[model samples]
Target: MLRERVAETIYVFTSSRYLEVAAGLIMTPQGCVVVDTLPFPSESRQMYEFARRNCPAGIRWVVNTHFHADHIYGNYLFEGIPIIAHEETRAMLERVGEQALEEAKQETPELREVRLRLPDITYRGRAAIRLADYNIELIHAPGHSSDCTMVYIEEEKILFAGDAVLPVPYIVGGDLNQMLATLQKVQSLNLESIVQGHGGVLLRGEIPETLEAAINYLKKVRSFVHNAVSKGASERELLAWDVEKAGLSRVPLGGMAQELHRANLLYLYRSFQKERLRRAG
Candidate 1:
């Protein structure tokens, strides 16, 4: 795991082994707060140890930005603390996460040690965790997933944008419209930077251009897929839509960006096909 201290009390941990998934730690006078966890316990445990050694007050809470296993699997390490997330996230974990874990363990034995830790504290729209000097705001920003949440530190103006914001907008099990709306909402925030769920942190100077590129990529993919589907293009043809052509670089996240971009195009193509079928019916 690669750890970088973004601020005086804020630390971002990126998993070097898996898709560059990012996690965060916020130190306060009261205690420490873990934003998310890594995919493997080995990497995640490093984060726990770092927090224990650095924050003498102890870890008060574990905040999951979403229900994705990559982000919440290591919650087992912080078992006692309050794990918070959007209500939908808890529901999704119960309804889908359980089965997914069992299947994952079958393929990857390391996941056998993981236990699903549902968020004990769940909110509808927004919630806040007030520390001595920081107010951690949890805002519902469903996009990458229906249960997506964004963690914003009011004092620092740093947003831990789960999958809601990434190098390329991925909507495989998510809604394109919702993702677009959420990106617009993020654009309106007075953000100093953004800790993306899957890549390096976006600094203040890179914020505007990165966000604009993501927004454009999402819009471009949707329009391209919709047009191709309208013209009755085959799935293979639609899948050929290059990531670069849609205004996104395939180099981010160690080339995983291209794969995600392909998935987005395929997802949009299928959704457009479904709409067409419904209209015909």
Candidate 2:
């Protein structure tokens, strides 16, 4: 795990490599508010200790940016602090949290130490969480996942953007269009920096280009998928299509990149087919 302080009270922890997700910590006058916990129990414990030593306040709350295993599997470490997230996030976790944990365990032995904790506090739309001196706003950002949320600290002007703004955008919620909109919303914000879910933080100067890159990639994928489906192309052919020629070379299909790519193609294909059937009916 790597740690860098974005502001006096804000810090970003990321591994930048495989099997690890970035997490953020916000210190307030009252206590420390964690944006999202790391993937493993030991890493979570390390972050907890880091908070105890650096911030006067301990962990007051744990926020789930999304229900992905890399972000929420270490929730058990903060058992007392209320885990906060979007209402849909909680629901999705309730539906698939355990299965996700089981699958994660198969990939990594570290997850065996994780206890699979879900959200204690949930909300819809936008919600403002006020700490002693920090104004953290939870905004619903659905694209990468239907329940993905971004945490913005008003004072620091920094955003914990979750998986919504990774080096390569991953579209799992069947809404590549919405994903672009979500990033556009972030682009409109008065942010000094953005802490991405799996990679390095983006400074103010780098924000626009990153957002544009992601938007272009999603647009290309959506357009290509739509055209292919209209022409009755098979999913296999779509998978074999040259992603770079289609303008998705910047997106790192890392980890299970191939699986994610295959899933995205099928998702768009199925969506177009269903729309066609609905229209015909």
Candidate 3:
């Protein structure tokens, strides 16, 4: 389920999961620039085919949004293309990528033979690539992971937000405050459409509303945990806080809502403790 469309010189490859999540290919007279390889090798191959069929020219630039397995696991599919990523992403890939590869191999033994490749070019803060027709800006948005970046095509008013702007919980290990701030930064962009890492594309006007919902959700979780902690509730007691109170019980987050909620609470509690200690100091 991939949707392909040409917006000026850029080709948008949107996923079918409610038309959420998308990768982009910017065609230049020199070559093509690929943004965020898909999760699986098969999907990466499909993307490659999509590019070749559409552009005929080869890919020369591959920009990875982060070190998440679902985002960069398809690096192997690109073979000789020069892959790029944030410096933090490079570090994470070097440290945890092999472990993730091994885990994937256990599920799909055929992938065992393929080795994970780290990015060749890494930048901190910001980086930009000037294609023949467009300038693609990669801005670091590290709350989601110290490595997450948002890809923006200034000419097209389109943003490939990676996992940083999903409608669901800001998972992938994040700092709640930092995540909220990052969402605010994204909201400030002059975007026409936001291609999220999951869920369908969001219109520009919808950015603030969606982001506020996510932020409010996080704030509610934090408040819930704080009150429980003040009451001297044990971790078990806190964990038992009703989902209805969290306003997420009916969201159909599969069966993992409980697990995610538990994790979110733990993270919030730890963050709260850290802030309290800083104030005490």
Candidate 4:
């Protein structure tokens, strides 16, 4: 895990072992608020230790931005802290968290110790948390997932944009249209920096370009998939659409960006195919 203090009171930890996924901590006068937990127990425990040593006030809350295993798997470490998240997040976790954990543990024995921790505090649309001088807003930004949310420190203009705003926008189990709307919503924010769910943090100067590229990539994917579907293209042919052709690089996230792009292509292709069949019926 790699740790970097993005702001005076905010720290981001990037997991070296897993897709470069990130977790964040926001220190407040009352106590530190954890944004999300790293995938592995060892890394998250390190973050927990860091908070214990640095923040004398202790941890006030744990915010699970979404229900993805990589984001919330280590929630057990926080123990008693009140967890805040979207209502649907809790529902999804309740529906499938245990089965997912069991499957994960079967694949990796290291995950055997992980326990499912559902969010105790949930809301719809949005929620606000005020600790001392910091005003934190949890905005519902569905794209990467239905329950995807972003954590904005109103005073600092820093955003912890869960998986909704990644180096390469992924909508495999998400809505492409929703992803576009969410990207537009993010573009409207006056942010000093954006801490992505994966990869490096986006500074002020890098925000606009990064967002525009993602937006453009999604648009291109939609168009390409729709056109291919209209022409009765086979799934294999649609899957052959290259990431660079959609105006995105295959380099981010240590070349995992290419794989994410492929997944997006497959998802959009199937969605367009379904739409066509519905129209024919």
- Model 2 clash pairs are none
TM-score of each: 0.98, 0.91, 0.85, 0.98
Query: Per-residue lDDT for 217-262 in model 4, tens only?
Result: 9988888988988898887898787888889888889999889988
lDDT of 1 by residue, 47-115 (tens): 999999999999998999999999999999996889999999999999999999999999899889998
Cα distance off (Å), candidate 4, residue 110: 0.3
Candidate 2: residue 63 lDDT (0-100):
90
Stronger candidate by lDDT (1 vs 2): 1
**Cα deviation of 90, candidate 3, in Å:** 0.3
Error of 2 at 217 (Å): 1.6
lDDT of 1 at 250: 82
Q: After superposing candidate 3 on the true structure, give the runs of residues whose Cα lies further than 4 Å from its correct spot.
A: 6-21, 240-261, 270-281
Cα distance off (Å), candidate 2, residue 239: 2.3
Badly placed stretches (over 4 Å) of model 1 are none
lDDT on C-alpha atoms for all candidate structures: 0.91, 0.82, 0.76, 0.92
Task: Please list the Cα RMSD from the true structure of every candidate, rounded to 1 decimal place.
Answer: 0.8, 2.2, 3.3, 0.8
Candidate 1 local distance difference test against the native? 0.91
Say what the RMSD of model 4 is: 0.8
